[model samples]
Target: MQQHINEKIEQFFRDYEKRFRDGLAGNVDTASITSAFADCFIEASPLGVHCGKNDAAFREAIPKGYDFYKGIGTTKMTIGHVTITALDDLHYMALVHWQSYYTKKDQTEVTIEFDVTYFLQHRNEELKIFAYITGDEQKVLQERGLVS
Candidate 1:
């Protein structure tokens, strides 16, 4: 049987989704999203590249990605298939599917979809993400012609 979605986790994603939509609309800042993650948060992209507290590669990559999207006339993004698993009393793991629609630098409108799992910790009554393992950054890049 399929487990029901958790309340807190659902609310968390709802908030995140709203913020992400705002970001795509250029109504909110990207730092707001980045701030939600831990300083040492680690991320393993779908391509298997790792970055986070132990690595800073994702920092540069993320911002560049934002710029790329904006340059490509990205106006909206949708996030779906969110599921949160309670890892313990104070920790949770979330799996989310995200799709971004944008015009490529060449003015081609395309959408890219990917899945990511995030490890979140509750601290001071807030959820902070410490890790994210993505499912297909390479495929996303290839689809967008960002990679050959």
Candidate 2:
């Protein structure tokens, strides 16, 4: 049963990623993305410090210079893997790694690979991200001299 729930949660994240990418590309309605995340609180690290208090707080805590409603313009999000550890019936933690390509309005493309940790909770049978941290892979690679 726990495994089933974990799979469902993983699927939810995958679907959410697809919707988010579509929204960023301006190929899908923004509301669809927002609606998909409505029931869950999202507390993004390095910003959105207090956003998990409630939905309204989350909306107001949008990172400076970022418009959640406007959505990011990402061309692709290729998730390499997602590993979920169930804390209990309603709580879980997951580690995800992915490569993202972002397209600017002028058509310039930037690629980034990141590893993220997600703390999730189930509310009303829907999975929501309660906390998350995104790590910069390029910085790590540079520090290790893997990239110049």
The numbered model that scores best in TM-score is 1
Cα lDDT tens digits for candidate 1, 1-148: 1143366666777778787666666555556666678777776864565656623564545556666567556767778678788887778899988886776668677777767898988777677888888767556667667556
Clashes of 1: 1
Off by over 4 Å in 1: 1-5, 46-49, 53-64, 105-108, 146-148
Q: Over the stretch 1-148, how does candidate 2's per-residue lDDT look in tens digits?
A: 8878878877977886776566555566444445545355555655434444445554444332133323444456778788999888788888987786665556666666777888877778877677777655446534543345
When summed lDDT is taken over every stretch of 10 residues in candidate 2, the lowest stretch is: 62-71
Cα RMSD for candidates in order: 4.2, 5.7
Question: Measured by TM-score, how close is model 2 to the native structure?
Answer: 0.65
Candidate 2 has an lDDT of 0.64
